[model samples]
Target: MTELVSTTPGLYPLPDWAKQDLSDLKGHQKHDLISGDEGPEIVDVYDRAREEVVSEQVDAGLDRIVEGQLRWDDMLAHPLTVHENVETGGIVRYYDNNNFYRDPQVKGELTFSGDVAAELDATSELLDDEALQAVLPGPYTLAELATNEYYDDDAAFLDAVGEFLAGEVDAFPEHETLFLLEPSLVTDAPDEDLDERVPDAIDRIVDATDADVVVQSYWGALEEKVYAHLMDANVDALGFDFVAGDRDQTLYNINEYGTKDDIALGLVNGQNTLVESPETVHERVEWTLDRIANKSFDRAYVTTNTELFYLPENRATEKLTALAEIANIPEVKA
Candidate 1:
């Protein structure tokens, strides 16, 4: 395992290339909109679109980070193939695809090609000493993509889809830990048994993939049972969105979860562009660090909860570069 270093805790921002990619693709992105009731079309993907976006992210040379993202042309959907069945893939009429989004659910092949994996591998190679992290849309999110799949039973599809989706990760080529984004899981569904299935689906993914895993949840606080189940997953890290979740502080104790495992302290805001100051960032970081007695990181980290996807490209780069500088900064002795 290649040793990776920490940015230590400072105000580093999103990568510069992110803004460039946004600019270069904004028009294209704007055109991709299908406008789901939940939000805009920024989340959609354009078949092979990642080829260019990932290329630019790697070229940006923003070490210690991955691109904000490249997925479903619809707004945030990925791994979804285009099809007439809305559950699998439906034309929302807001987005355009080279035909990828035309089919929302993934098609025949459950695996990625060496060519696709090679591109990811190239990005990972650029990480230098840092572990390359990538995001895999969470099972529930994938279930959302199934909105079009029109399955007779949603839960069953979630299970079958979970099994299939796990294969995608088993096939995806990358290092570092991969994040399974489950923002929707932050809250529960009154109708379904999320308590048992959600984490179970994640386990299926874990059992399927070879890389270290990070189960990330945002938007709302996770239920005690859900958090407890995640603790048992033995994942490399757990990511939470402090800004959106907004507890009264000392959130960890509320659930009786200790600092025994890895946790990504997501302090930055992905929805706002206020550009938090370095000192403030440092303070928050040090506060979190103190909680663990500066305990040499049982895999600790700070994250930008969601992507600054809405922010313009230039500003995004400035933020990312600042973050890299902070991460690479040398510790000063008192």
Candidate 2:
């Protein structure tokens, strides 16, 4: 069996120069490459200055990191739109040009599937020198964000997107890394007496992938039952957002995971300019290692809770480097 590898999640936004390139993506307009305020930019990572940032992250010591999610905002801008199983343009909104619309009141085209797959190919090539963990916004997240024109609830939205995404994942295994950003999946499941409707949605989405699926939860930790189910799910990894969440003891629950499953301890802050120190990271890694070892987990990783789009360039670099080193860190014994 292939060993469960480690990696940081994607979207550590680009630096000043790279950011400038993104801010200037006006003509020859990139879409879907990165999500943006309105409509996704389909630009290839190799073609943009942001590619340089991705390359730099790999050089900075990330055993497996992203191409810096150079074009996610652009992709989010255009998001996937599906209407009655047909294609339309897309639903777009503007937040001073930063793409912040997740109104499930309208339906649009769900055509980024091919585009997403293509870019993953490009992403794979961009990281040809180092291992990469490709990021895909979870179907649940995307569905919740969808502008549902005719759909009744978030469930319908997620199911469609899940099927589309499953097809996307089937296209490659070279990514070697796939982190599904479901920041709310675990925190939102309903109690056993009630029907949450989300865990099943998550299951459908994860069941379709050949790639190692990392069910990532940030923002908050739901009831204990929520995470327990997630741990026992068929996914290959569970990402705990230690940076933004209050999920400390969840690390000790590691024994519930499958042999191939991994634990991603998100220690780096991704939404701010505050650069975390390596020593602090080392200390945290020590604690995390102890917890996982107790649970008999041999594979674990570290990354930022969210994308680094909010962090300054230098800080992002330092945190990612520390994470890389931490991944190579030896396992602590009892």
Candidate 3:
């Protein structure tokens, strides 16, 4: 029987109070929230928010405790824009969605100063290594999100981004798993040669850390060719968005090329305001697993198809509670 675990893909929705408090702040106070030069008032707000967010995951009975990424302004671009070498350019659409992010223009050599590690370190104080899971934007996804001006060659830029992120991972606080969210692979599918190049870039990032790496792709499933090459990378597990993507194609890829030892199944819909029942989520997981009955998994994760930031805080909380129930279901474990 596959051991079922409940975890989020990681950018969690900020609670209503945090959103209200953040919105009320203006000028330097707002800027200080992301910058290191925060005042005591601003510091208190963020500390309280992160604590509350992390507590939500624990109270929900999630097996893996994600840092909730409450400090991130934008999931992909925040890490880069914070660096001295990168500049924040004009707002660009985030994939096909209505949301937008400031384009991270790479102005100089890519180097890791600091990103999610600090936030994860603070979260570590609340949870132990057994439950801690760190989240970061995948190297390929970051490369795709940024407007590269530093490196002349695209492949070189990709590798540099990988190395830069690897440096960040090398400094990360102790954790059980590292989730690299790679939504770009689905939203903006890379062509033939690029697909092959991506696995090499991903392998570099994976090679840097001792933590179990899960390369999670969302928004939709990857094409067969993309999926095949991704499987070649040295990753512990591959995550698929069963809620938003081509479920049939994802199952086919697993059956055709085969998958890693463990799999992360995105059964809960992150975008929708409506929450799913535990039984509904269980049924979906059982259906997918039954189709690939020939395969064996050491563990299977229950997750939201995308980041919960798209949904209301209450709805996201409800979604997580349901996922926990589904993981505990006798049939799901059996």
Candidate 4:
């Protein structure tokens, strides 16, 4: 029997209360906002927000739940930017969207500072009996997003970043599923040897973790060579953005390469404002499964194409509800 799971990619929008609390703390530095005397208050707000998202996921009957990543203001590049050795600099556009993230400036040797690990610990406590899926920005994406004043060579800088991220993955022993979010594979399309370096970096990052790891790329279809490279990486699953990318091309790659691992279909559009009907979602999921049936994949995950932070909280929740409904539909095993 093929296991059908419904999950989000991560970084859900903060609830209104959390957003207001953060807004009130405006002008305060990240340290003051997250660790100053008022830090406890912000942490409490995040807790409440996480609780709400967890409850919503449970209520929607999702098979896996995430912490909603409400603390990630810079999207996936956040953990790296908040590290002690890294400095936050000017804002840069995030992929092809209107959103932006503070560019992470590497001032010294890349190292883990425990901030990301601490967040994982907190989220683990909040999971209760539910299965927890941990999410992190992929090394290649993090390296692409940062300004390197420390490493003289780009390859060395990328390898150092990969080592730093692998350390982060080592900390989350409790997560059943770990997602490495790597949008830059499609957005930036490495024109150098960094393309070959990416899969090796991903392999190193997930090598020690016992959890099932999924490398999810969004924003657009990966270049042919990059896509083939990721398909051969040491991971359990690969996710493609059918909503945002060339769906036919993605399916062609999966078919041509052969689905030797689990496949996650990004059928839901997270960046849009319109809510999809349950029937429409069901049809799309069926469409994806129909294609997978001819392939040799072991499992299928129905998910949103990207983080839901682009949509309002209510709309995001609605999309989750719709996804849950689709997941509950009886599976037609291949």
- lDDT (C-alpha, whole model) for all candidates: 0.51, 0.57, 0.82, 0.80
Shift of residue 325 alpha carbon in model 3, Å: 1.7
Clashing pairs in 3: none
Q: What are the RMSDs of all candidates, in order?
A: 7.4, 5.1, 2.0, 2.2
**What would you estimate as the lDDT of candidate 3?**
0.82
Error of 3 at 330 (Å): 0.5
* lDDT of candidate 3 over 240-299, digit per residue (tens): 999886888888889999999999988899999988999998898888888875787888
- The ten-residue window of minimal lDDT in model 3 covers 28-37
State every prediction's TM-score relative to the real structure.
0.69, 0.76, 0.94, 0.93
Instruction: Give the local distance difference test score of model 2.
Output: 0.57
What TM-score does candidate 3 get on C-alpha atoms? 0.94
Query: How many collisions between residues are there in candidate 4?
Result: 0
The runs of at least 3 residues in candidate 3 whose Cα sits more than 4 Å from the true structure, single-residue gaps closed, are 27-40, 128-130, 331-334
- Model 3 alpha-carbon miss at residue 281, Å: 1.4
Model 4 Cα RMSD, 1 decimal: 2.2
Write the number of the candidate with greater TM-score, choosing between 2 and 3.
Answer: 3
* Candidate 1 lDDT tens digits, 94-163: 2222223343654333333222243356555544565566566677766654453344465666675667
Worst 10 residues of 2 by lDDT: 28-37
In terms of TM-score, which candidate is strongest? 3
